[model samples]
Target: MEDTTQLLPILAVHFHNDLGLATANTLAGIYVGVRQVDVTINGIGERAGNASLEEIVMAIKCRGEEVLGGVYTGINTKHIFTTSNMISKIRKSTKNITDGILKNKGTYEFVSAEDVGFIRASEHGIRLGKLSGRHALKIKILELGYNFEEKQLEDLFWRFKSMAGRKKNITDDDLRALILDETIVPQIA
Candidate 1:
């Protein structure tokens, strides 16, 4: 065992959902000056699970941003969804992980592994809307930007509701283009 103060470069903690180690592992990383973090989405681990990529990234964004001295996250907020898709494709290809949501299409779109940078194969994490208002708005805003006002959002909401009972009624294909546009931020020089 090494002193956590020295910040040993190599430390692998098994993930277990019994205690929610995902959040714990991320905080541990912060406890130590870890530049490179190891994480997976949904905390898929050998036994219980490992830390979640979203948890780590969100923690970094919440705590590391503008603080933690020289700590700077290497994730692009806008590309998060696409990146998750790419990671999923890679995992599927490698047989490391399973695609749980590929069954759902049209309503949303996901990227392929090549879309990210997974030349090799490995298991990774994915992010999605988790029944939270923020998640829904994030999915929308990620694709469409802030162009849609409250009224338009309300309209879309009502439209979704109107089609709620229909077998198939999401005829709005324009939203896909918006999702694709959820990339780099505008250069503000």
Candidate 2:
């Protein structure tokens, strides 16, 4: 590989993820002095797809300086998430590219959402379901600008439990509706 790089100084390596080794192979090429790499957004290709731009870029960004002998790419890491999301949208795939981004950005992600042009939505992180507890409900209620006493919170918890049993997931809008429906004083006819 070094000999080939010496011969063709401007050579670029193309990788296919047939056996899920494209990113690994591409990194190997870089280690062997390959100057360029070929990758596609979301790893979309004919069969098993090519090297994923996100995987490769993030791998380099996170490991290049420390592990890959100081080798690095000129990629803007912040545009990665946005680019992946755009490609997913264009391909009409059902995958939520930024779903992980909405939660704790560091769990499965090594980079920041802002680094990849992704603005995390405020309401996107509130995932309420039947399994959610009183604390979660109280937090969501507070986020919606509602303050309730301990007694009120207990009442809301029961109502939320009943509502959650009847629904698959409780959304922010639904939570707002529940608060209004229960709190509003009706005018006597």
Question: Which portions of model 2 show Cα errors greater than 4 Å?
Answer: 1-11, 94-105, 123-142, 145-175, 183-189
lDDT per residue (tens digit) for residues 1-189 in model 1: 767867656554434555756667566756565566667764566766677675566666666755444565677655554566676676673223324323343223244343334332212222222221333543444343354556655654444444443533232243443333443368899
Angstrom error of the Cα, residue 43, model 1: value is 2.8
Could you give the C-alpha RMSD of every candidate to the true structure, in order shown?
Answer: 14.2, 6.0
Best by lDDT: 2
Indicate the worst ten consecutive residues by lDDT in candidate 1: 120-129
- Give per-residue lDDT, candidate 1, residue 171: 25
Output the lDDT of residue 100, model 2: 48
**Pairs of residues at least 3 apart in sequence or in different chains that clash in candidate 2:** 78-115, 78-116, 79-116
Residue 100's lDDT within candidate 1 is 36
Clashes of 1: 3
lDDT of residue 188 for candidate 1: 90
